[model samples]
Target: MIAVRHIGPPRLTAGLEGAGRLDWDAHRRLHPEPAPLTCEGLVALAEEGRLHGRGGAAFPFARKVRAVAGSAARRRGRAVVVVNGTEGEPGSAKDKVLLRRAPHLVLDGAALAATALGAGEIVLGVADEGSAASLESAVAERGLAARARVVRLPERFITGEGGALVRGINGRRPIPPGRKVRAATRGVGGRPTLLSNAETYAQLAVLAGLGPRRYAGVGTPAEPGTVLLTVTGSARFPAVVETPAGAPLGHLLDLCGARAGEGVLVGGYHGAWITGEAAVRAGVSRAGLAAAGGTLGAGIVMPLGRGTCPLGECARVARYLAAESAGQCGPCRLGLPDIAGALAALAEGRDTGAAADTVRRAVRMAAGRGACSHPDGTGRFVLSALEVFAADVARHAAEGGCGRPVRGVLPAETAARLRLEVDWSRCDGHGLCADILRGLVRMDEYNYPVIPDEPIPARLEGDARRAVAACPGLALRLVPRS
Candidate 1:
């Protein structure tokens, strides 16, 4: 039998609720005392408990704290604390749940982290209006009006990144630059900033209330303390599950009423697909998942149901990811659509050799050509799909069809936005769109234009327009942005 423990607020639920209000007094109870406000103290505390960031990348919290503390102390510059509540991953709701239901817990964590690092300010950046409002109201109720402020951000996936959030708070658009930058090194008005996801802050709050030893009491030796996972798909008890870091996946599925035999997709769409829950049961920590060739990206567990077509689902998600690209890089701008097209053709009982070749070439071209992880992540999603669903690929190759409909198991809106619609009746197969768009659009063996399912970059507007103009059948046009 599975176990469920409700932490923090009493009203927290498994489903997405719109901007639920929080009670600061009740929420503050989650943290009994303020955290130690020094780098040495915080690091020692974190190291003692072996706490890691709750975000997808489970880097040690002590290391991150040390980095900011050492730098800020050396430069005599203020260290800023940012609570990252953007939660941009399509299928994630854990951060949003924390912010909406227990905002004060997150604030306590941020405030404690700020005090520890000797930071002068705290900024909570949220992408959703509901989450932002809940946080803002909580801050006001806690009388932390002077110490912490909430900033509402535009809703874009990349904007939720640590660097992107820093840039957005600095009055810039929330898009990542081509080069890599760490928020802790220079973030939030150019200060030595300690930025982490909302759940990370909440964990800090928990640590503050419970001493390191006590916090370490519940989890594994390698990683201690509870983790929050947003579980869904083929699971009966799907919700924001709070369990020890190395909890068994089979136990979680049993608690959630999920079948034990089906394949599981750990992490979100950008995450890898695992064939069995036993792999998860053996270990569920970041390191454990990594050893299994999967990273717990965003802590989303989606089980492929017994009758679901894995390839069909993958194709659906690939198309969605292709559309989510920021449209700034050469390969992503051109390569993702080719990948999506190939998958779509393969799914629809068509010969996909040319399309598959395009996908391979595009994946290579897009590997490191983007400003953000958008291209890399999209490529990873597709490549993983191809590998995991090799049997399906073979079937498609032999029969030109998978004999399965593209079920909308992935997020629908995102999938719809990623699909490119072409009027076949008007197509003359002149392949002008492919000729003019080059890397972004290509002609398959059938001489039809295979366009990527992503947004066209402003940089490629000239070529895209030319392609549309050259279409003899007037069958090509850009899809309206959602």
Candidate 2:
């Protein structure tokens, strides 16, 4: 039986009360007696504590701070700080929780970072209105109106990316552009910027309070500090957890009431799949997870329930991610949907080899081909599913059916509502739609249009319109978004 533990303080737990709030001082106290912010000092403290980004990249805080400091000193330009509260990865709720419950902690971290980097301004960007309001109110209450500003951003999945957030702050659409743009070099009105996740800032606040030695005392030597994780899937308690880095995944699974038999999806929808609870023995640190061919992406640990078919779940998630694509890059815009469709075909037990081939080709084609890591992340997700669930693929291949329904394990309201209808009576098998919409609408071995699971992009507007116009059978019509 799975065991569950109701852990951590409640979301609205009082600010910095007792041991839990050791790092946080009341806004009034902190504001009135603001400490000097220094780059060398903060770097020494962070390096001593061995602080890392909690956003799952696990990039060293000292390195990132030093980069900004070095650049600022060289260029003779002031630095700017951005606290990213746009927790776009659906399953990761830790940042939102921190902003809502301990806004001051996040602010403190940002202030320390701003002072360290010699930043003139600090901006906190939030995805939801509630988080924005919470941060805004906290800033006002703390009398930090001059130092910090909170901006509410549209809640698109990719908008949470550092560069995208920077663009949105500069009055551009939240969509990622076609080229690479690092927020550190040019960001927030073309100033050098330091951006990190909200939880990262909070942890920095903790480091500031406890110093490096005290902070490193809790977690592993390699990655010393506590990390907040949002545990979901079949776990009984799906609350945000604050545990030491390098904690065993098994311990986390045990806390979440996860059963042993089912595979676990670490890192949320765009994360990897580990085959059993035994795989949970892998360390939760970034390097540790990466060594296991998985990542602690956004600190989301979702356990796939036993009853659900893993392949089906993967297809659903692939479809959702495809839809969420920024639609800028050619391969991601074209390839991901094909991959999703191929997975769907395999799930339905139709032309299994062909579907697998399509997925393989799409994965190869889409990897690292986007302005953001969305395609690469989604490709990793799909490839990990194939690796971890080899038996499921074989079963589908042999039986031409899985004997299980495709239960929606992935949370995508938009993709769930999208239906690709085939009017067999109208489909003359002319295959023109398949020809024109090559990436999205492909031909199955049997000559039917295999619509891959992804959002139709505006770039495909001309092609889709052409395909609809030229369909000899008049069987294809693009469905309007509801």
Candidate 3:
């Protein structure tokens, strides 16, 4: 089970915070606070504290508010506030803990942002059942159900993206659209929407309650505030930690009972790998992580045990990321699978002739080609694996195996099984299915359709439906694997 560990004197996780999850009444007694601030006041406070988005992007919170306010000023309708709590990153669980333990605090922040941005409605999108239930109950207990609502989201990774969450809430497919559209300018219901992760909102609540000076008391001058980190995989406690922003990485690892020389994956699956004792010296802040050739993506710090095969672990996560693609763009759909295939061959250490080189080339081809940055993020992840695990790669190349079993320190989900079924009797060989979903259906020599033996992953369902709709004879259909 996951545990809660606080470091460097808790701020966001103040009184009534501990190992046990806090309920509504208990939370109310601990911190029943309010901050009545105008849009300018909120922006001023954020700018003073240098509040940054707790999500992977690390965008400035004040700039986001200004953008949303400016965008809403042009539109005739009101603005929208969305608290993104999807937490799709496999190794990250900090947002889930906040939503479960301190629902009221999150709502307070959302309500504050909503008032500042002229938004009458607050929408919270959650993936897990426990978070959803707790938030809904909190909204009702605080008598906020009228203006606040909870939306259940699909478990796919892409659904957690900002634009994708807006699309899902607006009743569209929860995939990043094929073009660039800033959610702050034009968002849900054609109005500007202020969207940020759950931790961002919780931090906002803290900043709102304690002004800028007190909020700046915990962290460094550059990043002055406490940040949440989900510490898992080889840590003795495997807990969600709240630590001061500039705390030494070594101290946090030691607190979690991690050894000094272990290989660490900071920032989740999409983050880079830092090896050996050097990982200990890096700071926990975004700027500090960047100096160490890593990121603070979603604040996930995963340590690989010595016994685990790093190559096999990388391959597993690569395959999982490949299957998580939204399947709308060619680079993410085609290139990720190519990278995954090459990594699988490398993991097996069998006939890996040019497979390593192929993996390197695939990463280059995949980067910066998708509508979303999933491809770019995946490329970075795999490229770092190669750099940090160079010795492992050489050993596997020479010996045809590492001889170490994959411990699956990184979590992955099996792709759902689906297949394209063709009714030959009804098929007129229109080739429409091939045109709509070339990845799943291709034209054969006889001008009929050809399908692969493997199953179509869940991410490809939208394309599958479009292909079925485009079929002239209604011959193309998708069926679950038997």
Candidate 4:
């Protein structure tokens, strides 16, 4: 299970003293609910506190509110509020922890936003069944069964994208459409929608309770808030911790028990890697990470500890990320796999100089050319790996091996292998598994199972299990490759 805790003094996580999920009564007893605020008041407070989204994009929260309101006015329709708790990145679990431990906190924010937006409904899209169940119970406790409904989204890397989440709520394929579709202007049920991740809403709840001045007291002047981060990897300390925005990254590294081996991957797979020294000089906020040549995308910090092959680890994640492509955009379809293959060649000491050049070129070709921002984020991740691990690349170029085995310190689809199989004895030509496991399993001329010999990528594990459960014939099975 994911551990939940806080560093320094906890503000956003003040109510999380207990390990189990806090019920509404216990939640209100520990953290009293805030007095309701008007839309103008809420927007003004967000602006004054400079509250930005905790999602990877870090968009201004106030702007999102105004955009939704303005779109509603123009279109003559009511607004919709969406709380995205997918947290599809394997390295990130802060949202999940918040939902599991502090569902009321998130609901408070969503309820506040709904009241301000004049919206009739709230759609909470979650990554797993547990979070969905917790939220469903919380909604019932609040007597908001009519206003709020929880949906368990298909677990996938790109499923967390705003447009994609909206699609899933609309009962469409949960993938980013092959073009831009702003949720603020036209979203759920074809109405203006305000969409943001779970942490952003929780931050809003804290801001509403504390008001502007008190909310701005702890963090930096421009960025005032305590951000929740999923800190894990070779450090061996895996927990979701709440920290002030501009807190020193080195202090956190030591607090989290980092071995300080190679470097840290900030912002999960879509974020860049920073050198150990860079991390030491940096803070946990966006500007600080940017100064240190990294971005605080999605609030994830992962340190590469001693004895693991950093180059090999990067290549493994690169391949997993490549496998996460939605395949709707050309850059994601072609460039990602090419970049992954080139990085693997460099890691395997096949042709380091040429492979490095190929990775660089592929990254450029992929970024800014996707249907969504997935390609751009992947480019940032791969490019940062090349820059931070330059010495390792040079060494691997000179020698055939780095002499250290890849410990799989970083979490990704390649961490393990899973197989998809079908039992012919109970087999019927149902073809349900084939439809769900799209790119992996297929049906042939007779419309029966034609399972591939390839291993299931960990990113697709949820879909694999769903396929097994959905099989009418009960012939499908997914097992770990032994």
Candidate 5:
């Protein structure tokens, strides 16, 4: 179960100390409802606070507002406010924790944006049932059903991306388009849309409630506000934590009962690994994390303690990322699996030190080649692993192993299982499966079909079966995980 924890004075998570959802009345009692503000006022406050999206990108909130407002004004159309709650990054649960425990705050923030922009609608894209239910109940409480839509989007890695989430909201495939399309200019119903993650909206509400000066009371002048983070992996218990922006990373880890084994991964899967010394020196802000050689991407702090094989753990996550690709682009479609394959080879010491070089080459090839950044992110993950665990590379080279077992310290979601298997004995490298299931299957160097080892997405089950049927050699088959 998800729970809320805080490191310093809490701003976003105030009055939310337990797992129970704070009802509207209870929430109102605990924190004052935000005073009404005009668009200019909102933008001015955001600039003052230097407010940025709490989501992975840390994008400037003020710039987004201006962009949306300008686009809407140009078209003489109303803006659409989309609260992105589709938290797709595994090992992160801050959005879920907020939606479940403090739904009203999130709604209040969305409502604030809608009012400021004179938005046509407020669309909330949620992934989990609990978040949807909490939001729906909160919307009903505020009598906002007419103005707000709480949609349950596909719970996949890429589904939370701006274009993908917008597509899902528009009743299209919930994956990134083959090309770039900015959501600010064209979004729901082709109107200017002010889209940002749920925590961003909540932060806006906090800014409004406290005003600029009081909001600046919590964090540094540069990053003036608390940030929420999801602490997982080596922590004693998984938690969504509220921490001051410049708070020491070490304190946060200690508060969460973390044992920094094999160093700490400062961000999510896309984030790089930091040594324990860096972790102690690192601040929780984006600047702080960057200084420590990682982005504060998605605020996921994971660690691998002693006794675990770090390379093996990285290989496990690499495989998961390969399987979770939206399959919309070539880098994700083909390159991810290659990286995963190389990482596995290196981890298993299958091909000696050359596999490590292959992993590096694959990462470079995959970078900046996807419709989305999934490939780039995956590359970052594996490349960071190779850098942080160089000693493990030499050990495996000489000893053929790390001696320690993989403890599964990194998270790779596998709730549902769908496997695509190739029968090598009957197969003649027909490679039909590659053509049939473009997303799940790809052709290797020798024309043999390679499939992601993770479960097949439910949406692709039919395509998987078709590939099975179309295989001339009967080399491909799909089997459900029992």
Candidate 6:
């Protein structure tokens, strides 16, 4: 059912060719040369090569650097560079692979960007402690201890968001602010910050060394260069593979041992679901997946075999997302849970004949309503699941359940809830918490605060912190789930 062949040259993953972390010596040996250390030169190369951020946004990296550099130039202050290695998407592992195996390569890219932007400091953010240790060691080994610092970030999905990351590093709650603030203009203690994900920087390291023409040789004419794909689920060997941007999706899947006709979840949780053979034929590039009504989100290409219950998978992920909300906005707080509940009812065959409509309505209510793209992205994911699994829905609706068991093919991190603990001893029943986190904290009949059955999701974790801080009685405190 699958045809295997050579996948092609690997640029971003070239450092991963051998094993272990590419030490400073091996790194300098492989690279052998540094990029043009000027901002204009780097921007020109980026523009010519059409290099985009590999962190799912696909924004032109050159343009982003120019924006931050321009801002810094006008302000006459040193800018900051942030390397986002917090690969929070559960189905994605490319970032971690780079962090563990090729820290120096990633840092080289960061150094390039920092030099281009005239930034004095470079900050690398990682979710896990192991990555922090690895990066720290790499910085010391490369004699970058004075210029680069490694930061440990909370392992929450939303914390990986660019703005939230900036806020977190600044000692604020790691959540998106109500208003949009460009990091290029205002970030990292009010200085211009050039921020991008890890793989993006790794690609830049390769591009800067090769220059535009040679770097553009491998991928499509529109989007040139190699991409890192984390293949999981039904693949024979779940792995992180590197292929030229325009490589046929089918070949990449085949290389990973995915059979034809197996469903694929492209772009991770916020991405869409596409059927097997069609997905395989789709290009691995942004334009390729766009034609298939999908996006190459974080280059996560997961195969969903026929053996798993598609509805069950949807339900589990939906619930996990429902609990992962940052709770900063109303739609993300209220609508996600309702949508998750509807999906759960549908999966369990307990829908009251209106589950489909309820899901559609909740999705509509949730989209375009949050401070960040969380609501809209979550809605898109749910909508795609509904569209791709239409037949499965009908089967469940009629049979009271799909016979196949729930195989949680999709991955999710266990969410840590921020709990609002009410101390009656210090309580004056002022009810300010009920006002601040209205969605999570409710006013009891006696004016005390009543919390929800579920833990405080990430989106609302900041709000819970706010509620605790604002509590006049000092009775309320925020605690994490053990």
RMSD, each candidate, Å? 4.0, 4.0, 5.4, 7.2, 2.8, 6.3
lDDT (10s digit) by residue, model 2, range 195-267: 8999888888877776677677766888877767788776766767776677787887788777635577787
Q: lDDT per residue, candidate 6, 1-482, as tens digits?
A: 01112257656566565556777887787775465468988888788878899898889999898999999989999999999988888888888888877788889889988887778999998998768888998999988989999888888777788899999889888887888999999999899999999988888889888888998888899988888888887787677888888788888777787764546888888888887767978988999998988889888888888888887788777767777767667787787877877777788786537777788899998888788887787888888888888888888888887798877677754665556677889998888887876545656558777654345665567777888888888998877665
Deviation (Å) of 466 in candidate 5: 6.8
Across 1-482, the per-residue lDDT of candidate 1 in tens digits comes to 12233333322222223334448655544346574666678888778877777777777888999889887878899899988899887667788888877787788778888887878999989888889888878877878889888898877666786767898999887877667888778788878888788888888777767788877777677777777777776666666677677777777776677764436777887688776644446466786777766677788877766566666777777766665565666666667766776677666656656646556666787787778777777777777667666777778777786676655555534422222347889988887777776555667678777666555544466666677777788887767655
Model 3 residue runs over 4 Å out of place are 15-20, 260-262, 415-456, 460-482
User: Which ranges in model 2 have alpha carbons more than 4 Å from their true place?
Assistant: 1-34, 414-424, 451-474, 478-482
TM-score of each: 0.87, 0.88, 0.88, 0.87, 0.92, 0.86
* Candidate number with greatest TM-score: 5
Residues 256-310 of candidate 4: C-alpha lDDT, one tens digit per residue:
7885566889988989999988988799899999999988999999999768888
* Candidate 2's TM-score: 0.88
Clashing pairs in 6: 250-280, 325-459, 326-458, 326-459, 326-460, 327-459, 327-460
Higher lDDT: candidate 2 or 5? 5
lDDT of each: 0.71, 0.75, 0.83, 0.84, 0.84, 0.81
Per-residue lDDT tens digits for candidate 5, residues 292-350, read 88889888998777778999889988878877778667788678877887888788777
> Candidate 4: misplaced stretches above 4 Å?
414-482
Name the TM-score of candidate 1: 0.87
In model 4, the Cα lDDT at residue 227 comes to 80
In terms of lDDT, the poorest run of 10 residues in model 4 is 450-459
Q: Which residue pairs clash within candidate 3?
A: none
**By descending lDDT, how would the candidates be arranged?**
5, 4, 3, 6, 2, 1
Q: Cα deviation in Å at residue 264, candidate 1?
A: 1.5
Flag regions of model 6 displaced more than 4 Å: 1-6, 260-262, 417-482
